[model samples]
Target chain A: MKTPTIRDVAQRAKVSLKTVSRVINNEPSVRANTRERVQRAIETLGYLPDLSARSLRSATSYALGVVYDNPNAYYVISVQNGVLSACREQGFGLQIHPCDSSSPRLAEELRDLVRRSRLAGLVVAPPMSERMELVRYLAANKIPFVRILSAAEDPADGYPCVYVDDRDAAYEITEHLIQLGHQRIGFLWGGVSHRSSPERFKGYESALKDYGIPLDKKLVIPGDYSFDDGFRGARRLFALRDRPTAIFGSNDEIAAGVLAAAKSCGIDVPYELSIAGFEDSPFSKQSWPALTTAKQNTEEIARHAALRLIAELRPPGDAIAAAYAKNEGFSPQLVIRDSTARARLPAAD
Target chain B: MKTPTIRDVAQRAKVSLKTVSRVINNEPSVRANTRERVQRAIETLGYLPDLSARSLRSATSYALGVVYDNPNAYYVISVQNGVLSACREQGFGLQIHPCDSSSPRLAEELRDLVRRSRLAGLVVAPPMSERMELVRYLAANKIPFVRILSAAEDPADGYPCVYVDDRDAAYEITEHLIQLGHQRIGFLWGGVSHRSSPERFKGYESALKDYGIPLDKKLVIPGDYSFDDGFRGARRLFALRDRPTAIFGSNDEIAAGVLAAAKSCGIDVPYELSIAGFEDSPFSKQSWPALTTAKQNTEEIARHAALRLIAELRPPGDAIAAAYAKNEGFSPQLVIRDSTARARLPAAD
Candidate 1:
């Protein structure tokens, strides 16, 4: 059987060969209805744009690369789903590359990935997105990319990024605890490498100041984002001479650990010590008390990042500008659940 | 910069062009050490095989498609990781296509995917793998594919499949519960469409027969493989006058639900009513009691399936035969955790 060609698609869609070419190239000039008609025609004819031919005409390929290094499977999966959704919408394929950010050969591996895959662009996920050197490398190479980041403000140099307002969300969660009559509130930190950790800490500190409560250095515990860290952090807080009435974990995984630690210590939740977490992940909802956390729409953030990257890869046009304009920062909302409540009196009595 | 050719790789690796071609094509004739050297040379030179040129030489393309329609994110992610690992090792790109099995256009959509992506083959995941009609369609089209399935036996026709012995695993889990002195155990099932559900049920029934315990219809509850279903199933069991001393969930998610339901009903886990779940998913460990369940090596199974598929795609040779010979079945191991315990006396007394 003879393979269908661009001309066949054009004939079926009642358009010129040039119009079909524009649609196939994802040019913004084509009207939405005409583009849909061409897409349907392409589907009906089983048309596959010859990648080699397309490469000869343009340097870009029809594939987008997603580079991430995250221990949280839930977060990684969510980001992939979002990126895949965007890729599918634009008739693009996704190449997921799970790499270790701390690896010595990180830059070399990324460069190799781009050259071999012939990727059109990339959607970078955290904490890889947080790496300045990697970002600089990609920028220096002029590779089209978008980053999913946790930052208080967008970079002044205008590198495309989808920012998450972790600091603001953390402050809101802390303020929620303060409003619950908790003066002595404990804070658990995630990994120092993650920008979200420091941003969230700043928010918590700001909330304490806003509520006229002195920031107790002893109440703050240093730990990573793992459940084990949350568990150990809570235990350390419990061992203190003046135990806190409320404990705020950096993320839901940490909060869930805190719940486990409390249970192990024979302490009742909410009634004795209220606890809250950041990132309304599965750990929050699956926990016994169902953690009160900030809902970070990670999937949505990733989706937008992918879309933004694709748009940037397209030729300069109104659509590309619109796509760039849509790259707005996100603020996670506070979700109150059973884990957090009014502070209780000391059980020492 | 000029593109590096296969000849360049040959020179760099200090091997003949034929050897480089053999390694690039993933032929079995290349020695392991020689193949490694060729791969390193390819990586060093940033070599990308021209897909168009390769397709002209052979019907195969350098891409593999993964088609799945699973609600369980963990399962899907694990399968992708496994498939991706194999693809990377073999220098093939992966195209993930999440589709509804019950869709009227399922076959058409699949055919379109193959034509457009120019996929050399596919890695099919359940419950799509359970659909015989889809399997027949792929076979009729002469598409190279491997299925990841949970079944009692391999099909007689011998289309490549990586089978999980769900029946054996389920029986082992049931036997563990029986030994724990829980004769009156409730059973919650997954979706009827899934072959694993019935296979697991059969194992449960077989265990009861082995122990000379009559299967109680009241104790068996129909449910999908979901947390909500587990919660509802447990509630129904609790509503019964002769409630079972223990409950067995079809999967970890369901068991986690049972844990939540038991807690809400003021029933202590393992003591008041022991609960056991199948598939040692993250849900099992994250749950408060840490579910007693069967550990399904899904990742390993998927990895094997991918390896098998890649082997099948290679030209007929000794290595290909060896790959086919390595298609061994898997039986999930029973893992005892905090959720299950000895049966207790009736609380009615």
Candidate 2:
């Protein structure tokens, strides 16, 4: 028989992890009927609330450390808001720390933060998620953690995670351009170390291959994730004798940067050149024509991940098992805006 | 003789309130030398190291509740960071609750947060700084607090505070603009009811007066501290038949927003218009031409505030008094960047 966790209980309860936490804390104002149903589910599932470690005595908390790098203001703000909401529901406080994802100091910082707080668990946001040392540190420390994917991890077992399906999203976006009758598409690659960069590239390639389009290696450009980098990357693409008809920048900042570069070079958006970006942020709306981008639901991801960590702090109840069995992966929703259109590919008949 | 509090001892010992707590409880790890110093300080100041109401504690810690409602990312981030840093150093936990600055729920939410966590203190940010009900409620309830200014207050018997000199900073900035040959300068205003808005406007007015320039009510525009407001404020100023030669925005977001609007209108920057902003934020650099603004040193302010709050938790000593007197007020540093230039009036001789 598969052992149950509190997360399973949350899933079965049809409530957020925070909601379950409130119930466990015996906090008031919960709808009486709903509480009764949750209680019934709990009794039926045979869930046992676990408190094996001194952590219970120290503090009965569902605390999780959220660490991030790649300081896109919108991304950080969204993630913070999501984590805050989840923490509120769980009766937990998130310990936020910003670290250089690639720095050797990362492991040290995580260790200090965890040891100092005696954390219940963790949630790692890229580019820290892709670093092996981070993964190894979390594993070695025996801390349950979920990593937001910059790339897809195999089998997703080390610690259960909620991830953005970047690959599919990227592929669909690229396909949208192709379907719009664009032949040559320019790719803006984020920093190579981020696993999502390659995954997104793969998605683009797969879509092209599926459509019987020959890949042009020259059109793929690499740059760090920033407005300046985006601007520069687009500039390189534009300077080419055979410029791509449309561009796919890594993220919104890069897309904006690309837009600025194009405008300065006498190119109009969506008319002379179409562009698309990832991670629909405030920047997307603020952009000149508004950006057509993928909405990653960073807040939802943070909330769910926090919910998972908090829920797992409880002992396995049968209801939790039932709940866990219901929801496994959450698919992202696409948001359409004005930044993209059918590419005006010269090759179009 | 004046009675002392544990904050006094902590300040004198150059340790945390938690450390003072440990010393009072005779918990381990305090050096013999430091312990003796604390003892001597306690004796000299006749301070009580213990709060009998709180000292008889249970398993849970005394949490600090923070209520805020400003969207200036840097400001929000800094405030949280400061509170977190203090909480960590004090060995106490903080629960953050976001409340509307203008909502009646502000007091209710704060009271609820306090009741739920059994909070020991609060750090109120702007918007709430001027809320009389909030101040009265906390006073009536005997909740200790520190208010980051939205307005100046009567200093006598006021709670220990950490505040920004908005009027002074604003005055200095406007004076700088004046020195660089600007008249008919624009003054962007912040939201109504925030005491700082009028205070900042006063500084701009005073600076113009000092230079013998007439206060043109036409140049003062009202908006919130938002990017969109910045854009609109600039538009309102530019739409005038005789637009100001230089613009001083309320905050960095507004400044950046206005900067963006200027670019959209195809106005030659610095050549045709001079722009200056307050709050030297990351957004300033992110702007196209960068921004010359005031560096309020959020980190230092937060660090000092946290340290001050902790300092107030221990028994007082002569050394502690010396330390407190040394750190009364911090001046905001004027961070001049790429955003401002000497103004050339519309019809210059």
* Most accurate candidate by lDDT: 1
CAPRI-wise, candidate 2 is incorrect
Off by over 4 Å in 1: A1-45, A50-57, A346-349, B1-58, B346-349
Chain B TM-score by candidate, in order shown: 0.88, 0.79
Local distance difference test, each candidate: 0.85, 0.72
For candidate 2, what's the RMSD? 10.8
How many clashes in each candidate? Answer: 0, 22
Query: What's the distance in Å from true for residue B258, model 2?
Result: 2.7
- Ten residues in sequence with the least summed lDDT for candidate 2 chain A: A48-57
lDDT of 2 by residue, A85-187 (tens): 8777756656676667767677866765665455677778877776777788778866667666654433455655666667888888888888888888999
Q: Candidate 2: deviation at residue A324, Å?
A: 5.5
Candidate 1 vs. true structure, TM-score: 0.90
Question: What global local distance difference test value does model 2 have?
Answer: 0.72
